[model samples]
Target: MRATILMYHMIDTPVTPAEVRFCRTRENFRKDMQLIREAGYHVISLKTLLTAIKNNTHIPDNAIVITFDDGLACNYENALPILQEFGYSASFFVVTSKISGFNDFSWDYGFSCRRMLSTSEIIAMAQAGMDIGSHTVNHVILGKAKTQIAIHEIRDSKAMLEDALGHEIPHFAYPFGSWNPTVRDVVMTAGYTGACSTMPWPNRPDTDPYLLRRSEIKGQDAPWQFRLKLHFATNTMPPITEMRQLTRKFLEKTGVISLRKF
Candidate 1:
């Protein structure tokens, strides 16, 4: 079975210059959902996707999984109804530390100030059938932190989410799509069933469940660009990400940049 995972962030208007990449206008988001339907894709939850991968079962040829990062309130206010309108399920990865407060990303990324989903909103969405996954306690990039720090970020966030929701969080998405061998090992030790990455490609049964490939759906993408990305070419090049990783590593070694800046 082959499946594609789509990654998203804020689903609201771009009020600031930096939010242009992360915030998809409500009208465009609705249109994207419609486009998915018109393209004949079956939207599946993260649990179902992992189950099919584990069991090596046959899934629909056009299967796709939708996911949102940061657990922004707009997901509950703007995205959920559109998802429900089309009968689709999505996975929401929440930053445990940022819930019920303004997202801390604005200072670094130039995003407009916005509040994240409160605990009650998250619970309601989970009860309503959205998968709640962890994006770590403070949105720390695990690949750059010290071993102990990364482990704490991984395990503590999972424990926090499970404790609050009274259920296990079976999935995770590495912050900034940054991870290394050690980070993956810590994620496994933390007991998540699977993790998603920013890598752009569809997953087959043979693909590593821990490093599940995903395509980012940016606000700037047109409907046609979204369609091209699903095909694994012509819109965003995954290899360029690889090059950027190499550059980052080189800069870190030369002391030209700090890993924390990533």
Candidate 2:
């Protein structure tokens, strides 16, 4: 069976004329969940899915791993109930600094309400059956940072998550799919066993655990487009990775300062 892990952001009922990008309106989310259920798929946590993959444990024919990044309040308020309604679970990768629920993240539009889960909220979610993972301290794009900064972001974030969750948070997601050979080494050194990426790659076997590929659910993809992506999405790895390196080199050559994957 092929292991498929799906990434999602917020699941709120989109406010009229949705202003956010990369987030799903509540109606779409409902449709998605309904579609998954109707398709006979089981939505499971990252650990459950990955353990099965790493250990060759068997999974039902239609099992799928569901995940949410950015630790939005909507996750607790909106996404959780839907998953629970369907008896499913998900893994949440939260940026630590924003946990105060004070709107810390300023970059993206969903960030218009970007706030990390409060320690209390995270504890609540954990208690309510959600696996917690780290996005990083400040959501820095590690691949472009200096080596020392990159090391801090990678190592320190993992430690922070372990401290907050009071257990191992061996899984990770680069602040922005920002990955490279050096970044991978730092992540491993930081004690992460498996990490996900924002890159578009296949979820079939023999993937690099340190750079696991994931499908991003941008707000723009229609359900049919999503189906198209799953069937036709680029799953190639070696050449794609080489191309990433070449792009980095070009950025360096031009000092364009690309922080794309991070």
Candidate 3:
């Protein structure tokens, strides 16, 4: 019952140095799909994963769930065709307020602001058998935000997305993978069946549905690195990653690196 969930953000060539960590080139994405096929893995939808978790049933071995965050236009324009070619299903966690608009929030994080999916593109993907989930209305970091703000971000985004797609948005992704127990409760109380967190591990039967773990595939990852992450559920040692993150935060806080330029 162990399953690995792969998280992606943008699907295009990196235009800026900052974008490299989150953006994957189209060719690499296709190659990753081919690698999945070669590795004897089964790509499952979020709905399938959630249903199994809810019903306490068996999930296929080597199950991998693909997901994209931020609703970037390249997801529809570049990622979708390759996914269809592989006959695989993926879940997209979109920022509801940014649909059909540019990702202004990314600019604050030093990422090149990019266009987001249009309503038509989202509907088309949903019709084509993809899962559409919420990444919140503004991609707010729920762990640090106030309780009411977290509630609004969780509930309103689901409502907005459901209204747009004319169906229930059953899952959510914590923005920047930030969440606490209170935030997790809000997601469940909002009626979502499951939620994703960037915990960098494969999920097992006992895993919390609201905090399902994911491994991110970065843009600059070599094929071997990708394979390592695919097999190990993480590309780097946890302590090393934590140190790097702490250092980055310290630098940002000390005005050593501006977030917009970091």
Candidate 4:
């Protein structure tokens, strides 16, 4: 069976005007959960879905996996309650270095700094039935990093998170969705059962479990647009990703963009 993994970030006041595109309001988030139920989709944990796929077991037709990236405080303060209200389980991929730290994982291009989840909050979420996966120790983009550096990021982050939660951290999400063959190999070697990518698509049993695709949920998306996203696989995400990549290349070539501070 095919399954959709929906990606989310902040659910609070936009850190910047541009971020509003991805930051959903609390009311809209609640309604989104309602719509998922109304549409008859069963919200399942990433671990459960991946286990079913690995075993070639049957899953419901309306299966969905809810995931949040960056482990922001807003996710703990806002999104968790709403998910609990719907009795849904989610995987939150956290930047282990940032938990309980004041710094956030800033997008190389966006330069936004937001509060990350605290260590206590992460533990609480795990105890409450949410899966805590590692994003990285420092949210490094493994595609560009040296091989040893990338491996350390993947291995050490998992160790740190498992220490915090007192359980194994067996899932991951690529920082910035920037990955290549090398990055994929390191994640698997580091022991993750599966890892998520921002690339938008539903997954089948044959799909690479290490590079699972996920569709982003935008803040500006209304109910109708959300419905369209669910109904249409990939939809506008591929073209958008392509355009963004092209733009990045152009900016770098023109010396208009450079790597930002970690």
Q: For this target, which candidate reaches the highest TM-score against the unseen true structure?
A: 3
What is candidate 4's CA lDDT for residue 61?
60
Reference-based TM-score of each model: 0.88, 0.80, 0.89, 0.87
Query: Residue 51 error for model 4, in Å?
Result: 1.0
Ranking by lDDT: 3, 1, 4, 2
List, residue by residue over 1-262, the lDDT tens digit for candidate 2: 4556678877764443333555787777777778777767666667766676678777765566778887888888888888888888888988877886654555443445455568888888888888888887778878888889888877787788788879888888887678788988888888887888877755555667777777776565677655544443432323446767887888877878655542
Off by over 4 Å in 2: 13-19, 108-113, 229-262
Note the Cα lDDT for every prediction shown.
0.87, 0.73, 0.91, 0.85
Residue 219 of model 1, lDDT score: 90
Return whichever of 2 and 4 wins on lDDT. Answer: 4
Candidate 4, position 28, lDDT: 89
TM-score of candidate 2 against the unseen true structure: 0.80
lDDT of 4 by residue, 2-67 (tens): 788888888887777778876989998999899999998888789888898899888886788989
Model 4 segments more than 4 A misplaced = 107-112, 235-262
How accurate locally is residue 206 in candidate 1, as Cα lDDT from 0 to 100?
92
| Sliding window of 10 residues with minimal summed lDDT for model 1 | 231-240
